[model samples]
Target chain A: MKYRGKVVVTLKSGVFDPQGVTIKNALHSLSFESVEEVKTGKFFEVLFDAENDAEAEKLLEAMCHQLLANPIIEDFDFSLEKVK
Target chain B: MKYRGKVVVTLKSGVFDPQGVTIKNALHSLSFESVEEVKTGKFFEVLFDAENDAEAEKLLEAMCHQLLANPIIEDFDFSLEKVK
Candidate 1:
Protein backbone atom coordinates (compact mmCIF):
# COMPACT_ATOMS: atom_id res chain seq x y z
CA MET A 1 0.00 0.00 0.00
CA LYS A 2 1.00 3.60 -0.49
CA TYR A 3 0.96 6.07 2.37
CA ARG A 4 1.34 9.77 2.94
CA GLY A 5 2.92 11.17 6.09
CA LYS A 6 3.12 14.55 7.71
CA VAL A 7 5.87 15.07 10.24
CA VAL A 8 6.62 17.95 12.53
CA VAL A 9 10.04 18.30 14.11
CA THR A 10 10.62 20.75 16.91
CA LEU A 11 13.53 21.61 19.12
CA LYS A 12 13.33 20.29 22.64
CA SER A 13 12.21 22.70 25.32
CA GLY A 14 15.00 24.73 26.97
CA VAL A 15 16.83 24.87 23.62
CA PHE A 16 17.42 28.39 22.38
CA ASP A 17 15.68 29.23 19.12
CA PRO A 18 17.65 32.01 17.46
CA GLN A 19 15.48 32.08 14.35
CA GLY A 20 12.33 32.40 16.42
CA VAL A 21 13.91 35.12 18.49
CA THR A 22 14.93 37.05 15.40
CA ILE A 23 11.44 36.78 14.01
CA LYS A 24 9.88 37.92 17.27
CA ASN A 25 12.18 40.93 17.32
CA ALA A 26 11.35 41.74 13.74
CA LEU A 27 7.64 41.52 14.47
CA HIS A 28 8.07 43.90 17.33
CA SER A 29 9.90 46.34 15.09
CA LEU A 30 7.03 46.10 12.65
CA SER A 31 4.82 47.52 15.39
CA PHE A 32 3.31 44.16 16.34
CA GLU A 33 3.93 44.98 19.98
CA SER A 34 1.31 42.57 21.24
CA VAL A 35 3.28 39.58 19.97
CA GLU A 36 4.87 37.88 22.90
CA GLU A 37 6.93 34.96 21.53
CA VAL A 38 7.60 32.86 18.47
CA LYS A 39 8.97 29.37 18.07
CA THR A 40 9.92 27.75 14.79
CA GLY A 41 10.35 24.23 13.55
CA LYS A 42 10.27 21.97 10.49
CA PHE A 43 7.47 20.24 8.64
CA PHE A 44 7.79 17.35 6.25
CA GLU A 45 5.37 15.63 3.88
CA VAL A 46 6.39 12.22 2.68
CA LEU A 47 4.96 9.84 0.10
CA PHE A 48 6.06 6.24 0.16
CA ASP A 49 5.03 2.64 -0.19
CA ALA A 50 4.75 0.07 2.54
CA GLU A 51 3.20 -3.37 2.92
CA ASN A 52 0.65 -2.34 5.50
CA ASP A 53 -0.15 0.12 8.25
CA ALA A 54 2.19 -1.53 10.71
CA GLU A 55 5.05 -1.54 8.27
CA ALA A 56 4.37 2.07 7.30
CA GLU A 57 4.37 3.14 10.92
CA LYS A 58 7.64 1.34 11.53
CA LEU A 59 9.25 2.91 8.49
CA LEU A 60 8.08 6.37 9.51
CA GLU A 61 9.44 5.93 13.01
CA ALA A 62 12.81 4.85 11.74
CA MET A 63 12.94 7.58 9.13
CA CYS A 64 12.18 10.22 11.74
CA HIS A 65 14.75 8.91 14.15
CA GLN A 66 17.46 8.56 11.55
CA LEU A 67 16.89 11.50 9.23
CA LEU A 68 13.97 13.79 9.97
CA ALA A 69 15.04 14.80 13.48
CA ASN A 70 18.11 15.16 15.63
CA PRO A 71 16.97 13.00 18.53
CA ILE A 72 19.42 14.69 20.85
CA ILE A 73 17.97 18.17 20.41
CA GLU A 74 14.76 17.75 18.41
CA ASP A 75 11.56 15.84 18.90
CA PHE A 76 9.56 14.49 15.98
CA ASP A 77 5.99 13.31 15.57
CA PHE A 78 4.12 12.09 12.50
CA SER A 79 0.76 10.92 11.24
CA LEU A 80 0.12 8.68 8.25
CA GLU A 81 -2.82 7.84 6.04
CA LYS A 82 -3.24 5.40 3.23
CA VAL A 83 -3.30 6.82 -0.25
CA LYS A 84 -5.29 5.48 -3.13
CA MET B 1 -7.16 38.00 25.40
CA LYS B 2 -4.16 35.81 24.62
CA TYR B 3 -3.87 33.40 21.72
CA ARG B 4 -1.54 30.70 20.45
CA GLY B 5 -1.06 30.18 16.76
CA LYS B 6 0.43 27.39 14.68
CA VAL B 7 1.53 28.30 11.20
CA VAL B 8 2.73 26.16 8.34
CA VAL B 9 4.53 27.63 5.38
CA THR B 10 5.13 25.55 2.27
CA LEU B 11 6.61 26.13 -1.14
CA LYS B 12 4.09 26.61 -3.91
CA SER B 13 3.67 23.80 -6.34
CA GLY B 14 6.41 23.59 -9.01
CA VAL B 15 8.92 25.27 -6.72
CA PHE B 16 12.02 23.17 -6.29
CA ASP B 17 12.83 22.03 -2.75
CA PRO B 18 16.51 21.26 -2.62
CA GLN B 19 16.41 20.29 1.04
CA GLY B 20 13.61 17.82 0.46
CA VAL B 21 15.42 16.35 -2.50
CA THR B 22 18.58 15.94 -0.44
CA ILE B 23 16.67 14.22 2.34
CA LYS B 24 14.92 11.88 -0.08
CA ASN B 25 18.22 10.87 -1.63
CA ALA B 26 19.73 10.36 1.80
CA LEU B 27 16.82 8.16 2.81
CA HIS B 28 17.24 6.01 -0.26
CA SER B 29 20.91 5.69 0.52
CA LEU B 30 20.00 4.58 4.01
CA SER B 31 18.08 1.66 2.43
CA PHE B 32 14.58 3.05 2.91
CA GLU B 33 13.91 2.14 -0.69
CA SER B 34 10.15 2.39 -0.51
CA VAL B 35 10.38 6.13 -0.06
CA GLU B 36 9.16 7.85 -3.18
CA GLU B 37 9.24 11.57 -2.53
CA VAL B 38 9.61 14.20 0.19
CA LYS B 39 8.69 17.84 0.66
CA THR B 40 9.69 20.16 3.46
CA GLY B 41 8.30 23.33 4.92
CA LYS B 42 8.39 25.55 7.97
CA PHE B 43 6.29 25.57 11.12
CA PHE B 44 5.87 28.35 13.60
CA GLU B 45 4.18 28.55 16.99
CA VAL B 46 3.37 32.03 18.22
CA LEU B 47 2.06 33.28 21.53
CA PHE B 48 0.53 36.70 21.63
CA ASP B 49 -2.15 38.97 22.97
CA ALA B 50 -5.08 40.31 21.00
CA GLU B 51 -8.28 42.09 21.84
CA ASN B 52 -10.40 39.33 20.34
CA ASP B 53 -10.45 36.48 17.81
CA ALA B 54 -10.93 38.76 14.87
CA GLU B 55 -7.96 40.89 15.80
CA ALA B 56 -5.80 37.85 16.41
CA GLU B 57 -6.64 36.42 13.00
CA LYS B 58 -5.85 39.68 11.31
CA LEU B 59 -2.56 39.97 13.12
CA LEU B 60 -1.53 36.45 12.12
CA GLU B 61 -2.46 37.07 8.53
CA ALA B 62 -0.37 40.20 8.38
CA MET B 63 2.58 38.49 10.05
CA CYS B 64 2.52 35.72 7.47
CA HIS B 65 2.29 38.16 4.60
CA GLN B 66 5.14 40.32 5.86
CA LEU B 67 7.58 37.88 7.41
CA LEU B 68 6.43 34.31 7.89
CA ALA B 69 6.31 33.46 4.20
CA ASN B 70 7.54 34.54 0.81
CA PRO B 71 4.25 35.43 -0.84
CA ILE B 72 5.58 34.79 -4.33
CA ILE B 73 6.97 31.32 -3.77
CA GLU B 74 5.26 30.04 -0.65
CA ASP B 75 1.80 29.72 0.86
CA PHE B 76 0.96 29.79 4.55
CA ASP B 77 -1.90 28.60 6.73
CA PHE B 78 -2.45 28.92 10.44
CA SER B 79 -4.80 28.02 13.27
CA LEU B 80 -5.26 30.06 16.40
CA GLU B 81 -6.66 29.16 19.80
CA LYS B 82 -7.30 31.17 22.90
CA VAL B 83 -4.70 30.95 25.63
CA LYS B 84 -5.18 31.41 29.31
Candidate 2:
Protein backbone atom coordinates (compact mmCIF):
# COMPACT_ATOMS: atom_id res chain seq x y z
CA MET A 1 0.00 0.00 0.00
CA LYS A 2 1.04 3.64 -0.59
CA TYR A 3 0.36 6.67 1.60
CA ARG A 4 0.41 10.42 1.13
CA GLY A 5 1.28 12.73 4.00
CA LYS A 6 2.02 16.33 5.03
CA VAL A 7 4.85 17.62 7.14
CA VAL A 8 4.86 20.89 9.08
CA VAL A 9 8.19 22.09 10.33
CA THR A 10 8.82 25.30 12.23
CA LEU A 11 11.18 27.13 14.52
CA LYS A 12 10.28 26.55 18.12
CA SER A 13 8.25 29.18 19.92
CA GLY A 14 10.24 32.08 21.51
CA VAL A 15 12.59 32.04 18.58
CA PHE A 16 12.60 35.34 16.74
CA ASP A 17 11.15 35.34 13.24
CA PRO A 18 12.86 37.93 11.06
CA GLN A 19 10.59 37.14 8.15
CA GLY A 20 7.56 37.38 10.40
CA VAL A 21 8.87 40.61 11.92
CA THR A 22 9.45 42.21 8.56
CA ILE A 23 5.91 41.33 7.63
CA LYS A 24 4.72 42.78 10.93
CA ASN A 25 6.47 46.06 10.21
CA ALA A 26 4.99 46.14 6.76
CA LEU A 27 1.59 45.45 8.30
CA HIS A 28 2.07 48.54 10.45
CA SER A 29 2.86 50.64 7.38
CA LEU A 30 -0.33 49.34 5.82
CA SER A 31 -2.15 50.92 8.76
CA PHE A 32 -3.26 47.78 10.50
CA GLU A 33 -5.00 48.64 13.75
CA SER A 34 -3.44 46.21 16.22
CA VAL A 35 -0.39 44.20 15.25
CA GLU A 36 2.26 42.75 17.55
CA GLU A 37 4.43 39.74 16.67
CA VAL A 38 4.51 37.31 13.75
CA LYS A 39 5.78 33.79 13.48
CA THR A 40 6.05 31.47 10.45
CA GLY A 41 6.16 27.74 9.80
CA LYS A 42 6.61 25.36 6.85
CA PHE A 43 4.24 22.96 5.07
CA PHE A 44 4.80 20.05 2.72
CA GLU A 45 2.67 17.55 0.77
CA VAL A 46 4.04 14.18 -0.22
CA LEU A 47 2.53 11.34 -2.24
CA PHE A 48 4.04 7.90 -2.39
CA ASP A 49 3.59 4.15 -1.98
CA ALA A 50 3.76 2.38 1.34
CA GLU A 51 3.09 -1.09 2.69
CA ASN A 52 0.83 -0.11 5.61
CA ASP A 53 0.02 2.67 8.07
CA ALA A 54 2.44 1.50 10.69
CA GLU A 55 5.17 1.09 8.11
CA ALA A 56 4.53 4.54 6.72
CA GLU A 57 4.91 6.25 10.08
CA LYS A 58 8.36 4.80 10.42
CA LEU A 59 9.49 6.08 7.07
CA LEU A 60 8.14 9.56 7.77
CA GLU A 61 10.10 9.76 11.01
CA ALA A 62 13.36 8.88 9.35
CA MET A 63 12.70 11.42 6.69
CA CYS A 64 11.98 14.03 9.34
CA HIS A 65 15.21 13.41 11.14
CA GLN A 66 17.32 13.24 8.02
CA LEU A 67 15.89 16.14 6.00
CA LEU A 68 12.37 17.27 6.87
CA ALA A 69 13.36 18.64 10.31
CA ASN A 70 16.38 20.44 11.60
CA PRO A 71 17.50 18.99 14.90
CA ILE A 72 19.30 22.18 15.85
CA ILE A 73 16.35 24.61 16.17
CA GLU A 74 13.35 23.86 13.98
CA ASP A 75 10.79 21.12 14.74
CA PHE A 76 8.51 19.27 12.29
CA ASP A 77 5.05 17.70 12.12
CA PHE A 78 3.17 15.69 9.46
CA SER A 79 -0.15 14.01 8.56
CA LEU A 80 -0.91 10.90 6.53
CA GLU A 81 -3.85 9.90 4.37
CA LYS A 82 -4.73 6.95 2.20
CA VAL A 83 -5.89 7.83 -1.27
CA LYS A 84 -9.56 6.97 -1.54
CA MET B 1 -3.64 48.87 18.79
CA LYS B 2 -1.73 45.60 18.43
CA TYR B 3 -2.23 42.66 16.07
CA ARG B 4 -0.68 39.26 15.89
CA GLY B 5 -0.82 37.23 12.69
CA LYS B 6 0.17 33.92 11.17
CA VAL B 7 1.53 33.21 7.71
CA VAL B 8 1.31 29.91 5.85
CA VAL B 9 3.67 29.40 2.96
CA THR B 10 3.78 26.37 0.70
CA LEU B 11 4.49 25.09 -2.76
CA LYS B 12 1.55 24.82 -5.07
CA SER B 13 -0.15 21.41 -5.23
CA GLY B 14 1.28 18.87 -7.71
CA VAL B 15 4.69 20.32 -7.05
CA PHE B 16 7.02 17.39 -6.68
CA ASP B 17 8.18 16.88 -3.11
CA PRO B 18 11.44 15.02 -3.12
CA GLN B 19 11.63 15.63 0.58
CA GLY B 20 8.07 14.45 1.07
CA VAL B 21 8.69 11.40 -1.05
CA THR B 22 11.72 10.56 0.99
CA ILE B 23 9.59 10.96 4.06
CA LYS B 24 6.87 8.75 2.65
CA ASN B 25 9.44 6.10 2.11
CA ALA B 26 10.52 6.49 5.69
CA LEU B 27 6.93 6.32 6.86
CA HIS B 28 6.78 2.93 5.23
CA SER B 29 9.52 1.81 7.58
CA LEU B 30 7.50 3.01 10.55
CA SER B 31 4.65 0.58 9.67
CA PHE B 32 1.78 3.03 9.20
CA GLU B 33 -1.08 0.94 7.84
CA SER B 34 -3.02 1.86 4.70
CA VAL B 35 -0.90 4.91 4.00
CA GLU B 36 -1.27 6.52 0.57
CA GLU B 37 -0.23 10.14 0.10
CA VAL B 38 1.21 12.81 2.35
CA LYS B 39 0.89 16.58 1.88
CA THR B 40 2.26 19.40 3.99
CA GLY B 41 1.37 23.05 4.64
CA LYS B 42 2.54 25.85 6.95
CA PHE B 43 1.22 27.34 10.17
CA PHE B 44 2.24 30.63 11.76
CA GLU B 45 1.28 32.54 14.90
CA VAL B 46 2.05 36.25 14.94
CA LEU B 47 1.51 39.12 17.37
CA PHE B 48 1.73 42.81 16.60
CA ASP B 49 0.21 46.24 17.19
CA ALA B 50 -1.87 47.80 14.48
CA GLU B 51 -4.31 50.65 14.09
CA ASN B 52 -7.18 48.74 12.53
CA ASP B 53 -8.11 45.62 10.57
CA ALA B 54 -7.98 47.21 7.12
CA GLU B 55 -4.57 48.67 7.79
CA ALA B 56 -3.36 45.29 8.92
CA GLU B 57 -4.54 43.58 5.75
CA LYS B 58 -2.62 45.96 3.52
CA LEU B 59 0.57 45.49 5.49
CA LEU B 60 0.08 41.74 5.38
CA GLU B 61 -0.34 41.71 1.60
CA ALA B 62 2.84 43.68 1.14
CA MET B 63 4.63 41.38 3.50
CA CYS B 64 3.34 38.30 1.69
CA HIS B 65 4.43 39.55 -1.70
CA GLN B 66 7.74 40.98 -0.62
CA LEU B 67 9.30 38.39 1.67
CA LEU B 68 6.88 35.79 2.95
CA ALA B 69 6.19 34.26 -0.47
CA ASN B 70 8.19 33.57 -3.53
CA PRO B 71 6.25 34.44 -6.67
CA ILE B 72 8.32 32.07 -8.74
CA ILE B 73 7.43 28.65 -7.31
CA GLU B 74 5.91 29.05 -3.86
CA ASP B 75 2.66 30.70 -2.68
CA PHE B 76 1.75 31.96 0.80
CA ASP B 77 -1.34 32.60 2.92
CA PHE B 78 -1.74 34.39 6.30
CA SER B 79 -4.29 35.28 9.00
CA LEU B 80 -4.43 38.24 11.40
CA GLU B 81 -5.92 38.84 14.87
CA LYS B 82 -5.74 41.65 17.39
CA VAL B 83 -4.58 40.76 20.87
CA LYS B 84 -7.14 41.46 23.55
Candidate with best lDDT: 1
lDDT for residue A9 in candidate 2, whole number 0-100: 82
Q: In model 2, which regions exceed 4 Å deviation?
A: B1-7, B13-43, B48-84
Judged by lDDT against the true structure, how good is candidate 2? Answer: 0.68
How high is each candidate's TM-score?
0.96, 0.61
What's model 2's TM-score?
Answer: 0.61
Q: How many backbone clashes does candidate 2 have?
A: 76
Specify the CAPRI tier of model 2: acceptable
Per-residue lDDT tens digits of candidate 2, residues B40-83?
55566666555689977777676667656677777787778776
**In model 1, how large is the Cα lDDT of residue A35?**
89
- Per-residue lDDT for B1-84 in model 1, tens only? 999999999999999999999999999999999999999999999999999999999999999999999999999989999997
Angstrom error of the Cα, residue A78, model 1: value is 1.5
